[model samples]
Target: MYRAPRGTSDILPREQAYWRYIEQKVVNACQLYGYERIDAPAFEDTKLFSRSVGEDTDIVEKQMYTFEDRGGNKITLRPEGTAPVCRAYLEHGLHNLPQPVKLYYIASIFRYERPQAGRYRQHYQFGFEAIGDDDPALDAEVIDMAWQFFQSLNLRHLSLQLNSIGCKKCRPGYLAILKDYYASHTRDLCSDCKTRLKRNPLRLLDCKKPQCQQIANSAPRSIDYLCPQCDEHFNRVKRYLELLDLPFAVNHRLVRGLDYYTRTVFEIQPEVEGAQTTLGGGGRYDDLIEELGGKPTPALGFAAGIERIILNLKKQNVPIPPLPRPQVFIAHIGDKARDEAIKLAAALRKNGIGVIEAIGNKSLKAQLRQANTLGAHHTVIIGEQEVKTGTVILRDMTTAQQRTIPIVQLQEELR
Candidate 1:
């Protein structure tokens, strides 16, 4: 049998309630944070990411699914949400009206990376972005939205990991220090790190290799070298979080995998592991709008993978929507009763009562057996005896008791 492509997953009925719950929480949180919902395409021009997400980033460099379209224009399935949001911001000229256009999208983003636990090639993301302002308060607000989202889900053991990847002013100075530090230890670096040292030293700190991680500990911190303005912004963001009683940690090594992020970067992960660990993560991208050919807009947002969040809910063994009860299973004995049973079922349905029926049954006993297997609470049985008398037999499947009721009063009697 044909099956779904590798690294992709189908969300089936049994596990779908968790997705509904997560979507609800995210939508509700977005509403509370004053972020209007917006939708962009699943794919766009390949240059969108190359410009916004960065040429050196893993998503742009290797993971993107790009191809030439019919007219020979290069297009790509969006590997992330920010670039598309920025594209929309410019295409629709939203920057014309608002100071900061706050938007959010629940989208399925694509990638070509090796799939791992809680990760997929075609994964869903809950993303948000605020453009047009460089205010630190907005940074704190976006972070709070993510934090409160976890809290709303009753998710425990989550750590608020925050950092500031400085802007152009101070970033160069930090890069200088980082390059000098890494250049001295070139012989100890991995091939990838050695190459990154020249292109983007910040990426070297983002490597997951343990050998690379060790070398990165000695690299420069953006927090230390932030320009006066960026430093003030980062500090104010901290002050806001503190004032709101939201706890966060400074992970200097958390150089978010994207180059667009500036001044604020963060991730929300379950402090507990063994299953429900990284629920979702996102950070600020202050330069993305400008990179996408719009005004130099400051933005901060995050996206969570639906699969991982649902898996985390499963690990906690959360209860979901209960099975619905079928109020009546209509059973008919002869062809005449079967005709009338159809009318009865429709009438019952019109009254908002749940009804299940198997028509033209061979025997009353057989029909009743089917009703029991279906877990029907009440069985509406129309045999020759009841049909000829303008009455019906209502059997309480739960109590095994039977009573005759007039056809017109069947609904009222059941109620």
Candidate 2:
């Protein structure tokens, strides 16, 4: 039998409750924050990512699913969320509307990577972007939204890791210092870190290997090298976060894994011991729009993995509200009853009532058994006598107490 491809899994009915719960929370949070929703296509010109995410980044070099289309254009499945949003902002002329346009998206992100617990090659991400502005207050609001989103889900013990990676003006000098520090410990670095040191030195600080992390712990801090403008910006971000009563820590090694980021970068991580993985993160990509061939536009965003969030929710045993199901199941006793069942089902649905009509021929016992399995609150039984009488046997599945009611009263009874 054919099966789902590796690194991907089917999200069956049993798993939809978690997805629906997370999606509702996302929608509610975005509505409260006044962020409009925008959805970009699943694929885009390959250069869009190669330029905005940095050609040397792992997403471009090894993870992106790139291919030549029938028309001979290089197309790549979206590997990350922010770049596409930025592309949309530029393509659709969102800058003309206002100085700051806030938007959010819940989209499928594709990547090629080793699958592990809570990690998949294709996953859903919830991200929001505030573009066309660079105010520190906006940064606080974005970070606040990220923190409050997780808190809204009843997640506990999360840490806000904050850092300023300086801007284009001061990052060059910081990279020089970082490369100098890493050059001396070349032998101790992993093969990946060794390549990172030569190509993208900032990524070295993001390495997770124990030995590389130890070396990074003592290496140069980017905040120390921030230019005067960036320094002031960082100070104001912290001040605004403090005013908002947000708990954040300044981590020296908190550089994010994107090339477009500058000035402020942060992450939200669960504080669980031995599993302190990041749930989602985004930062100021002040130059991304300019890199994408538009005028310079300052933007900041935050994204969280849906699968990871659900995993943590399960791990913490957080309660999830179950998805709404049909309130009434229609089980018929005979062929004429089944025909009546169809007409009644249509009438009930047209009246805004949820109904699950039984199909095929089955004994009343078997039909009721199916109704019980579906968790339906009430079952409406129709047989030859009921059809002839224009009535239905409404059975309360929970109490096992039923009553004979006219067919016209079924809708009111449900309400």
Go through the candidates in order and give each one's C-alpha lDDT. 0.84, 0.92
User: What TM-score does model 1 achieve against the real structure?
Assistant: 0.89
lDDT of 2 by residue, 1-415 (tens): 9998778889999989999999999999999998999999999999999998889888898999899999999999999999999889888999998879999999999899888876788989999999999999999999999999999999999999999999999999999999999999999999999988888898899798999999999999999999999999999999999999999999988988789899999999888854538899989999988989899889899999999998889989999998899899999988889999999999999988899999878899999999999999999999999989999999999999999999989888888
How close is every model to the real structure, measured as TM-score?
0.89, 0.96
* Most TM-score-accurate candidate: 2
Measured over all alpha carbons after superposition, the RMSD of each candidate to the real structure, in angstroms, is: 2.8, 1.6
Per-residue lDDT for 289-355 in model 1, tens only?
Answer: 7777777777777888778877766777766554466779999988888988999999889889989
Candidate 1, which segments miss by more than 4 Å at Cα? 209-211, 273-277, 323-328, 351-354, 359-379, 392-403, 413-415
- Any idea what lDDT model 2 has? 0.92
Best-fitting candidate, scored by lDDT: 2
